[model samples]
Structures are given as structure tokens and as C-alpha cells.
Target: MGASQPGGPSLPQERRLVTAIPGPKSVELMERRNKAVARGVSTTLPVFVTRSGGGVVEDVDGNSLIDFGSGIAVTSVGNSAEAVVRRATEQLQRFTHTCFMVTPYDSYVAVAEQLNELTPGDHEKRTALFNSGAEAVENAVKIARAYTKRTAVVVFDHGYHGRTNLTMALTAKNMPYKESFGPFAPEVYRVPVAYPFRWLTGAENCADEAAAAAIDAVTKQIGAHNVAAVVIEPILGEGGFIEPAKGFLPKIVEFCRENGIVFVADEIQTGFCRTGEWFACDDEGIVPDLITTAKGIAGGLPLAAVTGRAEIMDAAHAGGLGGTYGGNPVACAAALGAIETMRAHDLNGAAQRIGEVMKGRLNTIAEKNPAIGEVRGRGAMIAIELVKPGTKEPAADYAGAIAKACHAEGLLVLTAGTYGNVLRFLPPLVMPEHLLVEGLDILEKAIAQVTA
Candidate 1:
């Protein structure tokens, strides 16, 4: 990561803190936000971004911070890549919206075609667009139910789908995502996930034991015949960057296929080039019956899609599967640009290189600090689970403190986990190596400060 991409923003690629974190201007903005915005919508860093491109985000107070979150894995390509800006600007000049449902557009169809061609499996496929990951997941469930003629849907522990009524039921977290928002959709069941870090049977046995437990739960509790689909994240996002044990996904997919249950991969966070592949499932050669994508799909534009086997996707009624803003022309243009940029830059390889650098640095840090329970993930989607020294007990406070310290030092990082002890890194694929190493330096200092 040398510098900004060609024709990207010209801002310097180094971290510079002119004022305290959430400086005076940001504090004033926060006051206005508190008065006007909903209290439920929270801010992580609260610095108020004014400009951003490549690896740096500039705040209103003139602070340039190294961005490691990438807007939660949405901007795999740099935020203002030339293609994304040019395409979206052209599309905006042409038209913004005509409602794809009322009057279909070529951009929407083109996006669908691209998804069909790019997604795993050579089988004939169809795609439906949506405004968010939750909507894609909701539609996927609908398609599965329509195709399989079943009601119950199965998910795994520590999996995060979305925040809607149905998705809240699909998501496993209970505090911020699912608390009091209940009366959630029914007929959703949760089963064991192959989490190697915390699995009692040991890492070697995690995949087999967890898969067997999941299969048993579905068969005995939900009844295999009643399951419409088995939904899972290739790598859990908000639930922490937990990569399932090797061989677990294949077993679950096989069981789903045998039971006539549709297999859905929620690739919202792990899709595109975030995991060094087109999708995380590709690592194990697992092609889901339905794949839901968002986040990195459109280089920060609000767009999500579900791509699946043709017959299954076509099961929904003609008028039952679209929204007003689904595949909005501008978003479609942005997605096309994002896809083009991914190929042009070989962002998949970039993600792999980033992963190599990060994993090497993080592993070294882990070796020096016993509080880091584990260093796990693939490509740029990596995380460190913090724990008490010499024990597996979660140290959520330590994780939070480290993240805050990084923020204060003008390096933006994010935290996750069911127990809230994971510090995850999702840097843009366009980030320069120097910035990444610099960010890691800040993180090391923060971790040392917290653990000491």
C-alpha cells in the first residue's frame, strides 16, 4: 500500500491528530446529532468524517486517521475509486430511480447478470437485489420456503444475520441487536457452530463434533423435513470474526442437501475480496444454494443481492420479490464500478497480502501477550480474541480499552464477539503497507497500555 490509487483523493496517507479524538467541532456536531438523531443510532468514533479515500479518513477538525474498519467491510475498493465515482456520477446524471419494480432498468439486470456469472457454481442462477443485507436474507428465506414448502429455518450459534424482525430471529446476539425488539419471527431454530476457539471437545474435534451436534439438533428438534433453509455466515461478522472449523461448512451443506433444505450463505461481511477470495465459502469449495451479499458489493453504496440456483430463485411469485430501491440505477452503477475495480486491481491478491502481513504481526503480538486468546481469520478479515492471561476467560474490558486507545491515537479500529472480546481488522484492500504497519504500531501501543 504505497499511496492513493490513481485519480483517488490526494490527501496524505499518514495519520495526523490535530486535536483530541472527537475534537471541538465534532463535539458540537455530536450535540446537534443528539438533539436531532435517534438515540438508538450510535457512533463508534464520533469524529465526523469530512473526506476519506484509500486508507485515511479526514475529520472536520482536520485530523487524518488511519481507517482499519473500512466502514465495516463495505469499501473493499478505496472509497472514492475513479471507476466508482465516474460510473456513479454518470448514472446520477442520467437518472436516480424509476423503481425497478415499476419499470425495470438495464443496470439492474446487468448487476444480476454479473452476480450470476461471478458467484460460485456454474449452475444456472438468478439474482434479486435489495437495499440491505437483512432484506437479502429475508428474501432468501422467502425463496427457500417457497421452493422447499417448509416453515422452519435453521441457523447456528454466534451467527449474525441482520437486524430486522426475521433477521433478529436469525441473529444470535442478544444485547444491542436483539434486546427488547422481540416478538421476533417464529419457526427459526439455533444450533451449534464449529467455533474452534471455545469448543470444549478441542480444536481437532471441533468440526466433526459441532457438525454432528448441529445435524442432530435440526433432525431431532426442528425435524429435517420442516426446515426450509440452513442459513450461516461464511465468517461471522458482528458476532466476531469467527471462522468455523475446517470441514464444518461442507458437512452442514451436505446435510442440508440430503434433507432437501436450501443452504444459504450470508456473505455480507465476508464477500467480495474481503477474505482473499470472491467469497469465504470458496476456501472450502462450498457453493451455497443461496448466497446473500451486501457491504462490499457496491463500494459503499446501499446495495445487497441474493444469487441462487435458477429454479429456486424463480420460485417466488413475479411481484413478490422486489423493492422500490432494489438495484437503484446509481447503486447498480456503483456496483459495476466496484466489480471492475476489484478485477483491475487484483484486490483478491491484495487482501491475501494484507492478511499475510496482519496475521504475521498479530501472531507476533499474541506470542508476547497471553491476553490475546487467539489470532484468527483469513485475508483482510482478521481478529484477536482477548482473554485473561493464561486462561480462556474473556477480557471484554481490555478489548474495549485497546480500541479506545487506538482511536485516541488517530487509528480507527473495531471490536466484536459474543462475549465482546474480539478486536477485528477490515482495512480497505487498497491500503498501503506502510499505513497498515503504522496502524498496527498504534494497536500494539494501545494493547500494551491496556494489558500492562
Candidate 2:
């Protein structure tokens, strides 16, 4: 049996290290996993987890590690949240799955209702649940096409949609996600995002001008009348949490409105209060025609959703919008609990507090280290870009070494962005301030040591 954590039944605050990171047991299990699992799959951190709670993950080897990655931002309310576990367990005991499309259930409808009410905009909205972020994104494209009767969809550079065929086409990065998986779906086009940190045009360019250039490029390449939708993450996720300039999203929305093209926000990674707001798009007061969500929605359960204006969503035929396991009852139950936890704990507020702490520390480090290029993100979704001193050239190898050092010292961080030189932080909103500070100290020391 795995070790039982302390601090009552619900929340555990301890990080107990019973053995080395991949001790004898974990190394053995990893070898087995390699044989059984596909080689295409990869892991970002070592220390295989068997159980997690609040802010810590307990590995099979019985070492408790502070989790900064939050299962890649899925466990926003924290792992094994009391409400989420209770609701999921109860639903499991009662009924596991009824296949919502075959025989609808109240839980599925309830989840849909929550999406409608919670997603940005006061406009009348409709929602459909699916099994993953990729599925939700694909379905949104279908809905947009049905509504506009158009063939073209536009996505921005550095934006990550998902892994499915259509979504892989939507994703901006070429390798890993879209590699070896193409012949991708056609009618999908890419536009450049105004990444102030790396844009050759310079950050001094106004948001409006940058946006106009992108819009003009799209209109010139593919007539707006032929475009069904333009999808984006308000703050790009895997592509380095790049937040577009102030006017970019509003400009895109205005262009979409004039052309009758749908605007979809892929909030899978930034949703559920990860960005200090319910939706990252909320920051700009932009209401997307359709919003796709997954990551933190079901509190670690496999559930995703597409929420949008009712009229646009209804364009799809009844049978065109569902999956066998869409809105699984247990997952819906977990979602209900997750939402409740967010409200009760004020995870949005927590995210803002964490962001202040993170940005403050990272910026302080940047002041001292010439190798640090940029620090950016909102709320809990933060990243630090590494570069060679006095140059914009990326230092991916240096970043990799720093990450390896952190792992050796029991801290886990993830690398992202096209250049692979940015270290992104996705700590659970429920993490303790003390633990967060400790991790920051370790991160700062590692960078100092490496740069020296």
C-alpha cells in the first residue's frame, strides 16, 4: 500500500522522502511502463507519483515531492481535493457511465449549464462536453463551419490547440505535436502572434498596428468571407504563455464580427482561474463566439467543453455534436466539486497572489542575472525566458541543465516555447506560500550557480 499522508483526511502538507527520486521500485516500474506504453509518449519530470494531495505528489518510491507543474495545470484545485474526491466517489458508487449521447443524464446537462453561465459574455450561450481538449477544439471548428458555411479556419503562431488531426493542424508548432502526423486538414491557416519578447517588429509597435498587419495578411491570403472561425489562446499555453498585446484580441474580434467569422478561444490551459480571471479572455473584455476548455475543468477527470453563443452552437445537427463518453457522470460530478472548490477557496484570488510572488522573484533574479531575458505571464501561469548574456539568442541547453539541477534538488519545473528556453510554472493554486518561496529560492540558486 502507498504511504498515507498526514494533516487529517482531506489535505496533506508534508513531503516525505522515503527513498531516492526513482528509487529501486520506480526504476523497475518505469522499465515496465516503457515496454507497455507507446514510445511516442514522454515525461517532463522524474519521480513517478503514486498519490498527490494539496501541494505534493508522493512517488511510488515513497518520496514526497512539491509539485510545481500541477500535472501540467490540470489539478488547479490541487490533487485529491476533498469535494472533488467525494463527489466522484459517490457518483462512481451510483453509476459510472450511461453514455450521455445514448441516454442523457442530468449531470451532463448540469455541466453544460455551468459552462454557459461561467464562460465570458452575458450573451445567451450553449455548451457541449467532450472527452478531451482536442475533441472540444475539433467540435468547435465543426460548429463554426456549420454556422458560417465557410471552409477556412485561422489560428495564430505559437498557439497550441490539441493533438487530434484537425487540432494538430490548428496547433502552431511543427515538431512533436504535428510532426509525422500530417497530411493535416486543409483550410487551416496560421498567422503570427504579436510576441513582444521575440517579435522582430519590436515591442514598441502598437497593438493595433501589429493586429492590423495580421488581419491584412489573413484577408489577403484567404478572403474573410471564406473563413469560418479564428481560434486562439488569449495567453498562449504550451508555446510559452505569451500574452498578446493589449489591443490584439479586440481587433481580431472586430475583424471577425465584420466578416461574420466565429471567434473561438482555446482556454484549455488558461481557463478555470489559472490566469487570475475565470477566463484569460476576460482580461481584455473580449467575448469569443466559442470557448473551448479542458485542463482544470473536471479537477483531473477526463472532461472538456465547448461553450458559445446559442445560435452559433445550434447550427450543428443534433447528432453531429456528441461522444460516447462525453460528460461522463463521474467526471461531471468531479467538475461540480471542482467549481465549488474554486469558489470556496477563491482560487482566482489565490492565483493572483501566487503570480505576484512568482513575478516578483523572477524579475528580481533577472535584475542580477544577465542571462535572464524575459519574465512574463498572468496569475499562476508564469514563465522565465533564458538567453545568452546581452543577446536574444536562446540558451536552451542552459535552461535544460538548470531544470535538471532543480529536479535533482526535488523541485519540478517544465520547459516550453518554440525556442525551448523558457521555464514555465504551473503550481497548483492551493500551494502554500512557504513552499512556493522555497521552490523559488532553489530556482534562483540554481540559476546563479549555472550562470557563475
Candidate 3:
């Protein structure tokens, strides 16, 4: 039997390495996948997953690996959570889809109600459901443009929105996300973010100088009157999980407010107790005009939402929004169950505790390893930047080596960052303390071996 985790029930929680990491079964599947799957669709860890619950993912190879990635922060309440499974199963037994737009469902309305009540602001709010983060973000921009009657959309460096054409223009990274996929949608402006670790001057002056520089550029170049929205990730997700300098977001929020531009918080990775709060915007009390959410919202189900002020949401014409499979009944049910699980288990507290534990361990690791340039991020979404010793040059090679080492040892870790030099950890909040410590121990060993 598996030990229980914080958020919900679990599978056999121990890390059981049977054969090797990619055992015979996984290797066979990989060979099959190589033939069937498209080359464009890549995988970080190729072990075919059979079951995942709480803090562990059981592979077809009969190995149970510690899940620190959480399906790229999609399983915040833990994979195959009890509530999610139960609710989704019940919904599946009934009606699978009639489509919310085609025929409304109570679960859709209920999920929207929960979102309206839970998202940052107290003002009257409305929520529109979509199938993915990209759709939600795309719709948020559309709503903003509709409300403001403007064309330009301002985005920041190191921000990751989604994979859609508009969001590809909004995202900052190249190579994987935007390389050769351009001739993207126009009227999207990119600006600087207060990335203290890579700031030109110094970390202390980063917030003020970077914010001022961003505002100045937006004003002079983009012309605030023509910009409909300023989209930013509260804590960057795919771009290394960089948390902007403390006062940075608030300054941008203020600027957006002054210019009548809808401030959109792309909290797809930072929301749903992942950042020790319901939303990252709550940390600094920075409310946005529109907030896009996904990833953790439905405990691994494909459900996304755009939640914002009622007036702003209503600005779109009657038939301007929605999709055929948007807010599928089963996904909506899973979302409600996920929300219930989060509240019932105090996942926010669980996330805060994870942050405390991870920071304490990560700080000690950074102290011993000069390759670790910086340790930053909040709650379950922690990351460490790798750099060359005695220099700021990104150690992307070291990052890759350590991650490979961890994979060989049965620890599931993910690499990120624009420079490809960041090791990001998004442990399930429900992960038991022992597993967390074990994962860290494996990481420490990998770091020592690789850096040495």
C-alpha cells in the first residue's frame, strides 16, 4: 500500500528502481513511440507512465519515480487526485460533452463561480472557460482589445504565454518555442523585465531602473493610447521561473492602470496555490484587469480560464468568445473537484511549507556549489540558476548533466531557462516530507558529481 500525501490519496509512494531508469518495457515503448510520434513532439523523460498519484509516477518499467515536475505544473493537487478522479468519473458516467456554448452545464457555471470568487480582485468578476492556457491568453487579449478598442499588446522579456501564434509572439524565448515559427501576429511589443539575476546594473537598482525603462519604452515606442493590453507572467514559467524584483510587477500594474491598458497576469504556472497563494498577484497585492489561468486549475485536465473584471469580460460582443470543446463537462467536474481538494487539504499551506523546506535545502546546495548561480522562486515552484564558477556565464551544460544524473538515479527533474541553465523543481504539494528530502538528497549527489 502507498503512503498518503498532503493533498489527497497516493500510489505506492516509495522510489522503487527495478531494472534501470528506462527498463526493457520503457525501451520497447520508446522504440514504438519513435516510429509513431512526430519528431516535433519531444519528451523530457521517455519512461512511459502507467499510473501517477500524489508524489509518485509509476512507469511501465515497474519503477516508481519521485515526481518533481508534476506534469509541468499541471498536477498541482497531485496527479490522479482522489477528488479529481471521483468527480471526473461520475461526470463520465453521465454526459461527456454537450459543449458549454452549445448547451450550458451546471458544472461549467459552478467552476466559473468558483473562479470569480477565488481570483485576485473583490470587484464583480466573470470567467470564461477554455481548453488550454494558450486559448485563455488569446481570449484575454481579445477581450482587452474589445474593451479598449486598441491594437497593440505589450509583453515583457523572459515571459512565456503559450504556443499559439499570438502567444508565440508574446513569448520571449527562441530555439524551441519561437525559432523559425515566426512572421507572427503583429502589434505585439516586447519590453524589459526586472530580472535581478541578469540585470545590467545591479540587483538592488533592478526594480526601479527596469520598471522605469519598461514604462519609458512602452510610452515612447508603443504609444500607450494604441496598446490594448500588457501581458506578463507573475513569475515566469518556462523562462526559468524568474520572479521579478519585488516592486517590479506593481509598477507595471500602475502604468497599465494609468494608460487604460488592461493588465493581464499570465498566472498559468503560478496560480492555484503553486506560489504559496491562490495567485502570485496576491503576494504583492497587484491585481490585474484580466488574469489567464490553466495548468494546475483542473488537476491535469485540459481546462483553462480567463477571469477578470465583469465590465472588461462583458466588453466582447455576444458571439465573440467560446469554442466547441471549451469547458467540457468532465473537465469542469475535475476542476471543481480539484478546487475542493485544494481547499480541503489546505494545499496553500502545503505549498508554503514546501517553499520553506525547498529554500532551506536549495540555499545550502547553492552555498556549496558555485555552479549554482542563484536560487529563486516561491512555494512549490522553486528553481536554481547554474553558472560558470567565478563568472555569470550560464552553465547550461552542467544543468543538463545534473538533470541526466538525477534521471539515472530515479529522481524526476526538469530543466528550464532562456539560457537553458536553470533546474526547476515543481514537486507536488502533497509529496511527503521524506520523499522531498530524498529527492533533494539525490539532487545534491548529482550536483556534486557533475560539478566535480
After superposition on all C-alphas, the RMSD of every candidate to the true structure, in Å, is 0.9, 2.7, 1.3
> Which of 1 and 2 is the better model by TM-score?
1
TM-score of 2: 0.96
lDDT per residue as tens, model 3, 1-452: 12464344547677899979889999999999999999999999889999887788889989999989999999988888888989999999999999777778899999999999999989999999999999999999999999999999999998999999999999999879989897999999999999999998999999999999999999999899999999999999889999999999999998888889999999999999999999999999988899999999999899999999999999999989999999999999999989998898888999999999999999998898898999999999999999999899999999999999999999999999999999999998888878888899999999999999
Ranking by lDDT: 1, 3, 2
As for lDDT, the candidate ahead, 1 or 3, is: 1
lDDT of 1 by residue, 1-452 (tens): 45646224577888899999989999999999999999999888999999888899999999999999999999889888889999999999999999998887898999999999989999999999999999999999999999999999999899999999999999999989999998999999999999999999799999999999999998898799999999999899888899999999999999988989999999999999999999998999998999999999999999999999999999998898998899999999999999999998889999999999999999999999999999999999999999999999999999999999999999999999999999999999999889999999999989999998
Tens digit of per-residue lDDT, candidate 2, span 89-187: 999999998898788778888888989999999999999999999999999999999999999999998989988989999998887898888899999
Find the candidate with the highest TM-score and give its number: 1
Question: Which pairs, if any, clash in model 3?
Answer: none
In candidate 1, which residue ranges exceed 4 Å CA deviation?
Answer: 4-9
- How far in Å is the alpha carbon of 310 misplaced in model 2? 0.4
> CA lDDT of each candidate?
0.93, 0.87, 0.92
Candidates ranked by TM-score: 1, 3, 2
Which consecutive 10 residues in model 2 have the weakest lDDT in total? 1-10
